[model samples]
Target: MSDPKTEEDIFAEVDAEIAAEEEAAAAEMDEPIGPSDSAVDGPGAGVDALVAERDELQDRLMRALAEAENIRKRGERDRREAEQYGGSKLARDMLPVFDNLRRALDAIDEPSRDVAGGVIEGVELTLRELLNVFGKHGIRPIAPEVGDVFDPQLHQAMFEAPVPNVPKGCIVQVMVEGFELHDRLLRPAQVGVSSTPAS
Candidate 1:
């Protein structure tokens, strides 16, 4: 209180305070900031994590695409099958009508045919038209001839007979013709098979 401070002393004290602040700031910058090891590896770790995430997302995308493709193919196959086999039941139900028509034709004798020529001709024309329609619709008859080799896939054995000069497993008689729609068998031919061995 007795001595008054001069301007120089005041200026020197201000300079000393600023110097101390600068020294403190410099010391803080020189020291390691945050965790030293983590700071060194942070960028690489971040890049690695991003790459792994990208790979995982890519894998998921590929699996989803593959599943979608499989579903599409399966749907296409189902549609094609539906289109090809849609009328199988109707085609099968009409077979008995065709068989009855054939039986009617077979039952007529020569005398009846001569007496009712016009009526017989009408029936024959109707039968032929029916066969033409069947041909148009991919329906074909499997008519197995007598003495042909019997095939279980296409023929149903109605009876077995032992006839002379007939080979075993050969067809001796055809009872009824089979029918097919496209590549599918609508009915198997009924036949009599020979049980006699070849001479």
Candidate 2:
């Protein structure tokens, strides 16, 4: 009563059954494994956690090294600054003594100059020794002489004096000698600037 199937039909049916069986087997194999089947947590998971911890520790170590380098650079800068300006207060205090020495030298006049020669020589020698000491410490005097052009940066004009021979704005007198430490002016020279003679 049933009709005989063709070869093509038989082959198609067999292929379909085979394909269905293969798909079912693949699905079974792809199913998620239970915790019991998984060996990850049983053996190598602790090693993976330790690796992660090592990476974090390495990051922290690099940050700490950078911070230490910054601190070292800051300390070096502070030390250099301290060395450069260490004697500022002492230099300021010694300025009055230099002024006194200059005043003593100026007090000796022509008539009394012969009588005060020995005292003046001693004072001059003391001043020269003091200046030598300053030179050793990188301090230099900046006293502008008469007929020198007035410079506002180095000279502070106390007053303007009329002098016939010198040009206007020229330095006529130095009231106090200035000083420099390295390239920076520690004090400006106190000076009397010359003006045109009164008409």
Candidate 3:
């Protein structure tokens, strides 16, 4: 009051107040006051918290997008498989009719083919049309010829026999033709194979 406080005294008083406030804060937090700790209380703290939240949200959004893409790709693959193989059962059932048609033609011997020429021609036409349809639909016949190497994957051995001049494991006769749908085997060709050659 007698003399206005000197600049030095004024600064000392302000510093004391700030130190007291810091002491109280440190006491409440159970830690020592430091420059770095003080910085965490200002406007910068809100910005840091907001930045952390933004990063977490961004991570979650990215993960969700990746999961959605994977689900879409899986669904597309399932749809394609269903489209390609949906008629497998129907195609399997129709094979018997094809076999019957083949039997009908084979029953007509060459000696009587001329006598029943018109009927035989009609049957032949039907067989040709059926085969054409089979080809168009990705169904192919596996008609292994005699002397072809026997393939266990594509042929079923009906029996094995020794044959002169024929290599072992070669086809001796094709008992029945097989069929395939796309890359899958609908039926394996039935065949007889040559046994091991005599020593």
TM-score of each: 0.74, 0.64, 0.73
Best by lDDT: 3
Put down candidate 2 lDDT per residue, 1-199, tens digits, no spaces: 8886654565566556555655664565467867775554444454455456555755675686679789999999999877877887788788889999989888878877788788778999999999998888888999789889999999999999898867899998888999988777888999999888766
Weakest ten-residue segment in model 2 by summed lDDT? 40-49
On TM-score, the candidate that comes out on top is 1
Ranking by lDDT: 3, 1, 2
Candidate 3, TM-score vs. the true structure? 0.73
Q: By summed lDDT, which 10 consecutive residues of candidate 1 come out lowest? A: 42-51
Backbone steric clashes in candidate 2, count: 0
Give RMSD to native, each candidate. 22.2, 22.5, 17.2
User: What TM-score does model 2 achieve against the real structure?
Assistant: 0.64
For candidate 3, write residues 92-184 as lDDT tens digits. 898888889898988889878979899899989998999999888889999999999999999999999989888899999997889999998
Q: After best superposition, candidate 2 residue 36: deviation in angstroms? A: 12
Q: Which lDDT tens digits does candidate 1 get at residues 1-199?
A: 5686654565565556555655665565566767875567553454455456556755675686679789999999999878777777988888888888888889999999989999889888988898898788888899999989999989999999888888899999998889888888989999999996645
Clashes of each: 0, 0, 0
Worst 10 residues of 3 by lDDT: 42-51
* lDDT for position 122 in model 2: 92
Model 3 steric clash total: 0
